[model samples]
Target chain A: MLVLSSPSGAGKSTIARNLLENDKGFELSVSVTTRPRRSSEIDGVHYHFRSRREFDNLRANDELLEWAEVHGNFYATPREPAERAMNEGRDMLFDIDWQGAEQLREKMQGDIVSVFILPPSMRELKVRLQRRAEDDAETISRRLANARNEIEHWRDYDYVVINRDLDRAYQQVLSIVAAERLRRDRSLGLFDYVTRLLDEQVD
Target chain B: MLVLSSPSGAGKSTIARNLLENDKGFELSVSVTTRPRRSSEIDGVHYHFRSRREFDNLRANDELLEWAEVHGNFYATPREPAERAMNEGRDMLFDIDWQGAEQLREKMQGDIVSVFILPPSMRELKVRLQRRAEDDAETISRRLANARNEIEHWRDYDYVVINRDLDRAYQQVLSIVAAERLRRDRSLGLFDYVTRLLDEQVD
Candidate 1:
């Protein structure tokens, strides 16, 4: 499983989107949230919007892999899809925050490869946030404050990518995925492959 | 440091040579060996040829990072060059056996990224060995036997690449190097970078 975490406007979302589009083996782990879905959001695509009761039930039943309560709403990663993806030999991409990445790593330490992305500078980050023009100045101020907190946990990740250039950051992410896939412990097929090699006639 | 280890005919030497030629940041850790230098081999380029007395002196003085006596010829990696390369912010490549890899790892556990290359099949390995026509059939047979012993320790490596296609395996290795460079623990600059990010004024 690949967990991608970054502060808002760090270009992680763009990189994640590109990875999903380009790599067939990877499927995003759509989160389940108790927050009201916008008209632009589709159920099971953007998030599986659920009632507070249902969210509580999932939490009680241990169906949530990692969860957080933010802005009086619950957001969580459902356990079933992630387990299924791993069993099926498909890579699962977790588009989450630092807290979510931490929870997931705690649950699945050996399986998780977490990456944290950082903006090149605070000025560039503020510019990117303002470019969206979706938030008011107060909201932007709150986000910048939140970003400092989020970036503090960059050391917890296995890899850190500075998003100075979108393309370069994305390419670095791709390279990381490729390299992690080649890790000897993860390649279970190597056992039988090596055995076959040893048994083969080499005369 | 990148350590590439493989049994003979697994294409590791070719990949190492290619990496040096293609990447400016990497420099091969030319080993010091007590073996007789071939007519085609250049001193200090292929290896730093030394006498048994000199090799023993270096070993006694603890100047060797990793060393092995192969078929009675002393082959050893000098510690100074690798330390110098690391201190200078240049990547060093170690083309060594499993024993040497283990020694190097012990000396620089956090810095060394070890990879083991495997040929697609034992037959293919034998074919490549034969194709070289440099060694007699007896020598080829001995090498094939030795390869099996070497391959048994593949589990010790961080990453394993099966060399079915030379170019593809080489590319995988290149990707590993790129990703390892992005590891958060390895990037010492990140501490100051993150500090700067947090301290910056955002209006």
Candidate 2:
């Protein structure tokens, strides 16, 4: 499992989108959220649009892998799909915050590879946010303030990529995924593979 | 520092050669050895051809970072070049056996990234050895016997690459180096970079 976390406008979503499109092996973990879905958003694709009550019930029942209340709306990752993905030996990608990442790490120690992305500069982050024009100046300022706090948790992550250039950062992220997959402990077939190697006769 | 180790015919040298040719940042740590130089070997390029007395004096004076006695010949990595390379923020590659790798790891715990290469099969390994025709039949048999013991040290490495295909294995090894360089602890500039980020004002 790969967990990617970043403050808004740090290019986490862009990296995730590139990985999903290029790397056929990764499946995104569709999160469930209580926020009202915009007309541009698809119910099951962008997020599993859920009522606040339903979201609470899932959280209370321990059916959610990780959940958090953000700006008065609840968001969570459902446990079932992620578990199924792992059991079937498929890699899942999570575009979550630090809290959710920490929860996933606690729940699946040694199975999670977490990366924190940072914008090259706070000025660049502000520029990116304003360029999107998705929110007002007040909201952008609020996010910028929150970004500092979010970056504090970067030390907790397994890898950190500074998004100075999109292509370079994307390549770095791809390298992390490739290297982690080849880790001896993560490659499940290696033991048997090595055993078969040992048994091969020399002529 | 990066250490690549494997049994004879496992392609550690091939992978190392590819890396050195392609990656400008890596410098090979030419080892001083008591073994006689082959006709094709250069005095200071392939190995630092040294007498047994010189090798012993270096070992006794703590001038070698890691040393091992293999097949009645002494091999040692000179401490100064490696330390200077690391201090200058350059990466050095060590094409050593498991014993030298273990010693380097002990001496430079966090700085060393060790990779163990494995051939696709024992039969393939034997074929590779035979194809090289560098050793006699008796020496080949002795190497084949030692290969099994060498492979037992696979679990001690940070990364393992199965040399099923040269290109694929090379890519994986390159990916490991790229990702390891981006690790939070290894990227020394990240802390100050992030600190400056936190101080930037939101407009």
Candidate 3:
């Protein structure tokens, strides 16, 4: 599984979307959130919109892999899909914050590869946020404040990509995933494959 | 620095050559060897030819990063060039065997990224060795015997690429290097970069 975490306006969502669209091998981990869905959002595609009670119940029962309170709303990753994906030899991608990423790392350990994306500069980050025009001045300021705290955890990640250029950042993320898959510990069939190779005739 | 290792016929050399030719960023770590230069080999380009006494003196002085007795000839990586490359923020590639890789790992630790290449099958490995026709039958047989020992060390590497196709293998190696360079620990300027980001105005 691959986990990507970045502060707001750092282009994690764009990179995640590009990976999902281009790489057929990856399945996005649809998060469960208590926040009200936007008009443009699909129930399952954007998030598994949950009632507060349901979110609490899932968290209490350990059915949620990770849960956090964000902007007064609860958000989480369901446990079942991610576990099933691993068992079935399928790859999963998690677009999450540092808290969610840390929780996943605690639970999944070596199974997860986490990357943190940094904006080119705070100036660029502010520009990107303003360009998106998704938030009012107060909300943007609040996000900017949170971004500093979020970036403090950059060293927690296995890899970091500076999102100076979206295309280059995306390519870096792609390369990390590709290389991680080839790691000796992750490639399950290697032992058997090597055994078969040893059995082959030299002549 | 990147180290690529494989048995004689597993195509590590080909991948290394391709990387050196295509990527100007990487410098090949030319090895000093006591082996007689082949008719086709250039002394400095292929291997730095050295007298047995010179090789022993270097090893005694710990001037060799890693060394091994192969086919009764001493082969070693010069310590100075690799140290200089790392100091200068330049990347070097080592086309060495598992023994050499392990020594580099022991000495450099996190500074080294090692990759192990595996031929698709033993049959393919033998075919490639025979096709090259560089060594006589006895020498080829010796290499085939040693291949099993080399394959056992695959788990020692950070990454493993099955050389099923040369182009694909080269691409994988390229991806590994690109991603490794962006690792939080390796990207030395990241601390200052992040610090500068923090100093920017929130508004």
Quality of candidate 2's docking, in CAPRI categories?
A: medium
What is the per-residue lDDT of model 3 for residues B1-59, given as tens digits with 9 covering 90 to 100? 99999998898888989999999999999999998888889988989999999989998
* Per-residue error (Å), model 1, residue A166: 1.2
Of the pair 1 and 3, which is ahead by lDDT? 1
Docking tier of model 3: it is medium
> Which candidate, 2 or 3, has the higher DockQ?
2
Top lDDT prediction, candidate number: 1
Worst 10 residues of 1 chain A by lDDT: A66-75
After superposing candidate 2 on the true structure, give the runs of residues whose Cα lies further than 4 Å from its correct spot: none
Q: lDDT per residue, candidate 2, A1-203, as tens digits? A: 99999999999999999999999999999999999896778999889999988988898899999888877888899999999999999999999999899989998777889999999888999999999887889989888887888999999998999999999999999999999988888888888887877777784
Fnat of candidates, each listed? 0.94, 0.85, 0.85
Score every model by TM-score: 0.95, 0.96, 0.95
TM-score of chain B of each: 0.93, 0.95, 0.94
Q: For residues B72-148, what per-residue lDDT tens digits would candidate 2 score against the true structure?
A: 98888999999999899999999999999999999877888889999988888888999988788998888988898
Residue A41, candidate 3: C-alpha displacement in angstroms: 1.4
A1-203: candidate 3 lDDT, tens digit per residue? 99999998999999999999999999999999998887778999989999999888898898999888877988899999999998999999999999999999998877888899999998888888899887888988888888998999999998999998999999999999888888888888988988887777775
| lDDT of model number 1 | 0.92
How much RMSD separates candidate 1 from the native structure?
Answer: 1.8
